[model samples]
Target chain A: MSRPVSLPRWADLALLPVINVLVAFFVAGLVVLAIGEHPLEATRILLTGALGHGEGIGFTLYYTTNFIFSGLAVAVAFHAGLFNIGGEGQAMLGGIGAGVAALALGSLPGIVALPIAVLSAALFGAAWAAVPGWLQARRGSHVVITTIMFNFIASALLVYLLVDVFRPPTSMEPSSRIFGPGGKLPFIHELIPGLPKTPLNLSFVLALLAAALVYILIYRSRLGYAIRTVGANPTAARYGGISPERITIIAMAISGALAGLMATNEILGVQHRLINDFTGGYGFVGIAVALMGRGHPVGIILSALLFGVLYQGGTELAFDKPKITRDMIVVIQGLVILFAGALEFMFKPALARLIGGRG
Target chain B: MELIDTAIGVFASGLRLAIPLLCACLAGLYSERSGIVDIGLEGKMLAAAFGATVAALSTGSALAGLGVGIVVSVMLGLIHGFASISQRGNQIVSGMAINMLAVGLTALLGNAWFREGGRTPSLEGAARFQPIALPGAEALAGVPVIGPFYKSVVSGHPLPVYLALAAVPMTWFLLYRTRWGLRLRAVGENPAAVDTAGVSVSALRYSAVVMAGVLCGLGGTYLAVAQAAAFLPNMTAGKGFIALAALIFAKWRPVHALGACLLFGLLDAVAIRLQGVSLPGVGQVPVQAIQALPYVITVVLLAGFVGRAIPPKAVGIPYVKER
Candidate 1:
């Protein structure tokens, strides 16, 4: 057998991701062509829709906020070698928690009510994740399978609460009443005079703050060291006096809390009320974001922004070409996951041979 | 008499519902037994369901639909094999990719082609699989107790139902009795040992994955052509995951998988029946609670509140030979 060729850090981190993304888009283009649409025209529409005007940019950034929270959630868990697919459920629970707090404290001032709702969202998400983490830690269950199961359970719980508990008698829809003014986060347009009115809001700032905090927690903290050590090699971590089980639970908790913060953008900022399936598959999208970003905070933000562009652009494309619905973005997302994640090393050997030459 | 009628109805519905779960569980069983963790079973089934529906609509033949469904599913299985076996990639991530791709492609193509909001038209006549009735079903219906049971629970079903029932024993025999099955199971348990024995680990894994694809295809065809008669967007819902839970609950054994699938199917049937109806002790049971029972049970079992589920030894790890 031949020895494996190694590439420099720049090629490994920067070059490979760009190549993979280009390949994904190339395949997505083929899909567009297969459906009797012009891929180039579609791409033009997407780019212009996402970046052409202030409103488009605002929508893109607004979507980017939710992705950032979910992406950071996946990255935190990834650092601990846990694949936390339950972000969907955790985010749903976060919405429920935020809804509960806002509805209960609706009469209070925004200074008091809003912060309580945000904290409630995190606490609820953490608690939902802690159960699966505890199960995996104590009983030796695989976190992946357990988290997947929890996603279903969480959705069921969400539906039950919406139908039986939250829905007002006067309303027929399975959703809560519109939240009070105190509960709603101020829109970004309100703060900045000239910006077009979009769902973009203060949660975008919160998402950035969360990203910075995650960077510090993962790279600068002692707990982060233990988490990384356990992830890399559990037997070695155990030998070095770190409890892998404890780290697993803690990492999952933090991951779930980050996922929960997405509600600050979706529920508190945009919808201002609890609704079903509002997470809109963004939690699953986070997996792609984290994988494409290579589990780094900086990479996650960039990838999240990319997905935001796809989402905002896809919506615009749908208006121009009914044949190309938002599902096109999902296809692109899948291709990205395939090339950038599962087949990540497919280009490595060739690239190494090209760069380093014969050994 | 009325009580007996209700019992027969529930049992019949339960059996019908169990076919898809049983087929998918068996599909997972084959792949996992050969060291490939196939979380993409859901994706494969969903794609196959769409493929089957489209082919049936075009050809007006249910068998043609089944053929196309199997081909589509096997293609996806090959992709998974390429990623996990050849490229030595993360099996879970590969499976995830397959799932998302299937979800997106099915909806996108279905919408573009049919223009019914991502749904295919309802299948009818020759396009749908008609239930087969046993020779003595009518005669048996006249007798007491066993008559209705035999007629409702044992007699009439589409071809896929019987195929699913037979797959269990076939899988068991293949896994435990046949030479190829032994090699496949050995590769899953310890691929290096199989390689040392001069048998090809990748070949065995690829075959197992192909077999999984065929079975999932049958399951998906059952959903669109036999069970539902049309392809609905996200129609598989979480049945694939439910089947996965059943696989875990069964401890990866074929006979146990049948039992587990039946148990879950029965729960589903009961949940459907109990909706909007209040019982004496339980009151009006929330549908979601019943729907969540299978997942909760799987989690508890995984936590070892029930028996332990030890998977195949080398499952999820890529095989790489040492120099």
Candidate 2:
């Protein structure tokens, strides 16, 4: 066997991730085939369903809005070398936060109520994540375990609040009352008249603005430099007078804040009320997005779009192909995580050999 | 007499619930002790439960179901081993992938094959693990506290319950009184030292991982075949993580793992009984608060409130050979 070699930077950044995604798709196709479905036909249907018409595109982009928030959340934590699996819990708490604010201030003007809801979402999410961060920083507890545990705790807490506290007297369902007119986010179609009516809302613009800000925060700022330094080497960072503990907590807070924004798209924009499990596994999907995007903002946007396509397409596929369920996308997501995140270096040595790099 | 019977019933139910946790916790103990962190235990158990249910439904043999469950779980464990051990990948990421994969595959396949919304047909008669009554259990039921305790708690459980009970002592003996156990512990603590002594670190870790798979398979199979008659989607329901918390609470010791799992099981049983029941001065205890207790206690314990739960020294670090 030949010794492993490094690829050129551009190829490392672009070509490798594409290969991983293609391999993931290939395995997904095989799974479809195993279920006695025609893979090519399924792919055609999926692609067409996700991108065929104006409404499909609108729905896809709406889903993309949520993914961008969550992917950015995971990426920010990755920059600080913290695996924040608590994104699911944080996002759930964020929904609760947004719901609280919207319910309380719904009679107020839209301009005043919406921002408060968004801010509350961020604060609740940050607080939810900060405890685990503080535990890891101060008490030597592993954040991964703590975050995983927090996800379950958050689920139970959500059920309790929804069933016992938030449910309306007339309703049998475990959900809060719908938000007032001021609390509702305007659909993008309302703003731009030519577009189809979909859940795509002002939150889409917020997601883009968030992506741009995250780009600046991770690359162009001094704190970004400190975060990256601490992630790369804690000992050297400490020698340079930067506190690793503080950076860990800060990065986690920022990550949690980004994750919290997902609630804006789901709760305020679409649901218009606090529903049980409104996040709908997008937080876990964010791990796949962050890994596939290689923790870059631009890459995250692109990968988020891809997942959105898969999700919208999978829903359509379920309608067309009775045997193929929506859960097929989860298999694809797992494969992407496997190939892109865990076995990321599996194809590296072979790729280097082909690209003619010197060891 | 009525109160005693209710207490006996609750204790018996607690013991039954503890069986799955006991198996998974012991499984985690082996893997973590050998320096591999397995967050995928939940996924493996879910897959095993699915496999066991499907196989038992078809073959009408509970033993065959157990066999298939173990095979399926072991295959997943090997995949984890290949990624973390041979490929030198991130163990946590690999475990997460395994978990997601199991969840998706089980649901998708179960739906495709059975068409019952991601569930197999219920097991019955020969397809399920029937409870076995001990000799003279009925005859001794007329006696006092000792007879009721012995008959209800000790007897009338399925074969797997006894097997699970026996596993605790077996694991203790294997881990403490054996040379292979010493080498396995050494590999987890210091792989370089084990490698310098000419033992294959990867080989020992793989064995430990396989052992974990076998144990999880038993727990999962028992869940479907004895405790429940059908395989439900997402049936493991975070018990894997609870077992993991119990493992930490036990501080990775075999005997302590048994105690911790039973305690958790008792908490679960009590929570179920207390639901909607108004106590003196407490007015209707919230079931959700009781349900969340295990996770909250774990977080507090992990934060060093109940002393430090130190993991294996080299745990979660992939060993790389220096060139």
Candidate 3:
């Protein structure tokens, strides 16, 4: 299909990622074997638990919806050459935003409340990200370090808010009161009949729409060109009349907004109450998703879905095979990140030799 | 007078808490000064802490534990070097990978071995670094403020604290008062020039990273065997990042790093002290605000609202030879 056949586009785009994932699974299988579990049976269990039935698929999609937001968050920043590791913090802030919105507008109809909640989440997340972005763009501070610090700060802030300010007098838990009926998001089954009763909601469709918007913004817009240019080479981008600082801030804000959108899945779709640590490491997992996806929208969707499967499947595996605990999933995730990111080129030379020799 | 005594006690605790941070900051200083950004400092420290705890528990020897810690840390260091220096991969990604691997591996192994929900058994007596009193502590007990302060703050820490304190000056001497320091500095600032000067850039970076690992080992050992008796999951608890912040706040200087670590340590102590204290006018200050104080200050510092941090010029860049 390729004219000169240097390395087929399909191989570069699809084969390598699949191969890396396979390697990760292979190592994970060995780990399972070490723990006296059958690897082949484990795989079957993971897949079936994640995707075999309507209820399992619903849970998987619920998780996938969250990952899509975070993965896109990382990818947007990647396009501008900034590492937005603060997605965790930003998403937490977004949860707070959702809480505040529900509290303020709980008397309104669902149609009115949902949009306000979504807007609030995105705005709150963007504000959180903007500080680091401004520091990087205007003050020459490193975004990565500032964002990491912000994650801790965000956690602290959330704990204070939930415990001191928002905690219901009747409740002992460090979580806000449940949302009123008007503020609650409709489940997917309610929106469309005959589906399983699960946490899956309108947020999944929102995620898909957001993906489409991100694709258009990134691949077909002027700002996208400027972001890509700055990421590729700042000096050249500057010479070409794009302001690097402006692009950096804009890109980071967009990343943060995307990350903030993740709150709708947990706060609106599932829990309907703001709780501490609700993010549950999804922000960090997003980094792996972004890297595995090669920072592309399509790739990100696929990777996010893959991680969602892993999450649901891993839970099942742990429950079924108590010896293969949930921590084993983290080990497999780490292996995937290690191979896909740090050792990305380990197989490239061999592949090149094989292709070149064959041709 | 009572308030002053409380303050002194807090200072002592702060000093104790500062030891691990001091080691980590020095480790980071060496690695970054050699132009290799080592975000994996947290990962290395955690791995070392686990190794130290397990080894100390098994062998009944703190020294063996320290050796195990250092070896594990150095192995992580070598992995970072291979990824960043050899393969020319992204330093941040590699560092993050190390952190993830360390966290996942430690929990998995700990759960498999002890089954106490991913924590090592608490060490006792010989298995841990016990606090040692200086020779004159008893004699000076009768003296006033200075005596108690010295005895509590400076004299009775485990050996690792003293070693960590001593490491500051050693690091200073190595970075400023030696030929090796100059070459290391040159490599970070301009690897091309170092290469032109016939020194191998990769070798310098690898050495720096390995040195960082050793320092991280001491820090981790202090955490597990001295600071606490067992290795808890996420026991490092972002101290590695705090150390990085301290390094930046110190502008990558050894002596300044000591001050930075102490300041963060003091912040932590104050946060603990302020947790439940009620004030007359306002009310109790929330612990979360105090807990977040250091990071807020760091953000302000990074924003250049205070001082600027200019990293090494060649940092995060692979030194590629011209063909």
Candidate 4:
């Protein structure tokens, strides 16, 4: 007779974030009550707004598409043990670079322009992340601090360019005028006459394709092993003759490029132009998703969807429920991060015991 | 009289802005030198700024406000130290958590209490910090070269301006002079060696970080009650982070941090003066680019890839006491 075993350590690891999110939701319900809203009704409203209607689904799909890119960017860096907080800045700069390519070099055919703009965004993001990577790899400077500093610098630089250098001739707002029609991503409105609704365009398909590529690259490639080995233990990798410096820099650059790609999708497919706060805190949220997903590709997709629903649905719930503002959703997000981060404390030992008992 | 007075006013404003930066840099120096990463200086400032505003607004006294700010920041410092230095948590993560929590909680409390997003209502001039006009400046006002600059620069700055200037020297003395300073340097350089001695490593680290918070709090309160006379939402902006850069670029030295801050403050003053003044060829440089100058400079200085700066060895590593 064998003792019944609990989840293997690997499965238990995945459960930690799930448990944390549930606890966070419970705590957040109390907050809803304090805000004078019915917690049950608010939860229902949030779910319905994000996933129930066709329009809600459209919004969720659009958000999930972009979020997947951001999540993968952070996850890639994490796999190399480099905390890349500069994704926000890199994505912003990437978006602008892509926008410039679209606006200035839009005379080219659709297929060429699209590929060029996306590639340019990826390159811009890579270059941005490379600076900090070089600093960390060669100089022994801390990646976390340097990346944070770079993010601020990137944001300020982008703001400087957007306002003064990139202002189009016609628009008075901070944003540039619409990129030439050739540059815009073909919307579902034009692609299919009777789609579920709205401007949730082909970017969604592109995003899913990118995620699939990422999964294969991370799980099956020799390069992925090097990045993971470096992340797990750099000294061990060095002993094994893998240059940690090269892997670290390559990982960061790829991460930045991925984030940049996400930003481009939003600017090209949805908004049609760059504006102040255009990235909409997507970079920061990506960190949360990456952490929540434990840096797994499938987990990242799931977390991105969860975040998209929370974001799109939370806003709708806030608007319908007068006392709740979009800001309330931020509190919930913050709570999720807090609880998610506390995952090490929340699980592990108990799960270990459970596995031990089962064994 | 008019020209001299205007020059003095501009200099005074420059001093006022420069003081907070210097103070925050000093806070950075203390924490970094003691081998603890202190990115929560922004949160400390925000708490101090809010505390100072609330105290000043309630008591109608800027002094009390400054006091409240300092105390609250010290408490926040202890919390940061508890998490990062003692408990072996990730320093960047803890710092970020503190910052986010401060942002959320400050806004949450402010709205709930005052019906605004982290904004304390503006105060009366009398209730706020006012610059002290130095008496000796009048005697030297007529002298050439030194007189205009001196009168313009040093004569009309508020009390915190003087405190910030004094802090550089005070920091130098504290870092170099006492037994405590030696212990601090030891801990920063090699915590194991410091731990071998009689003192508690965690306690020393907590003290250094807490002291930093106090200084940063003073800086924050100076911003609200003294510089602008009100607490504005997210008013700390990136100043605290910039101060951290200045701390590093200055090689974590007190005197150097002061010099770096003054240079930045001077650039800011000159830019403001050049507001309407067009260059002979290039028309007025846009305000947005001018605003980005400090951040742009920060990146350039940090990329000093010439030879990378090394932080304290024990910095950001939590020390655990073993039996």
lDDT for predicted candidate 3 compared with the true structure: 0.89
How well is each residue in A279-349 modelled by candidate 1, as lDDT tens digits?
99999999999998898899999999999999999999999999998999889989999999899989988
Q: Kindly indicate the candidate among 1 and 4 with the higher TM-score.
A: 1
Candidate models: Cα lDDT each: 0.93, 0.91, 0.89, 0.77
Say which prediction, candidate 1 or candidate 4, comes out ahead on lDDT.
1
Give the residue spans of candidate 1 off by over 4 A.
none
The digit string of per-residue lDDT tens for model 2 on B1-323 reads 88888899889999999999999999999999999999999989999999999999999999999999999999989988988988888888898898899889999999999998888889999899999999989999889977898898999999889988999999999898998899888988999999999999999999999999999999999999888988998899888989999999999999999999998898899889998889899788888888888888888889999877899998999988666
Ordered list by DockQ, greatest first: 1, 2, 3, 4
TM-score of chain A of 2: 0.97
Which lDDT tens digits does candidate 3 get at residues B67-155? 99989999999999998998788888889888988888888788778888889889998999988899898788778887888789878
From the highest TM-score down, the ranking of the candidates is 1, 2, 3, 4
* Interface Cα root-mean-square deviation for all models: 0.9, 1.4, 3.1, 4.6
lDDT per residue as tens, model 4, B103-139? 6556655555576655778977666888787887778
Minimum summed lDDT over a 10-residue window in model 4 chain A is located at: A1-10
lDDT of 2: 0.91
* TM (B chain), model 2: 0.98
Best by DockQ: 1
Stretch of 10 with least lDDT, candidate 1 chain B: B232-241
lDDT of 1 by residue, B136-159 (tens): 999988898789898879988888
Residue pairs in collision within model 2: none
Indicate whether candidate 1 or candidate 3 has the larger TM-score.
1
Question: Across residues A1-359, which tens digit of lDDT does each residue of candidate 4 receive?
Answer: 12333566656676666777787778778877875678899889999999998888888878887788888998999899888888888888888878888887677777888778878888888899888898788766777767777777677677767777778767677887777776788877679777676658877887788788888878899998999999999999999989999999999999988988876678878777776677777887787788788888788889999888988898798578755655555566556665665233445456667767787
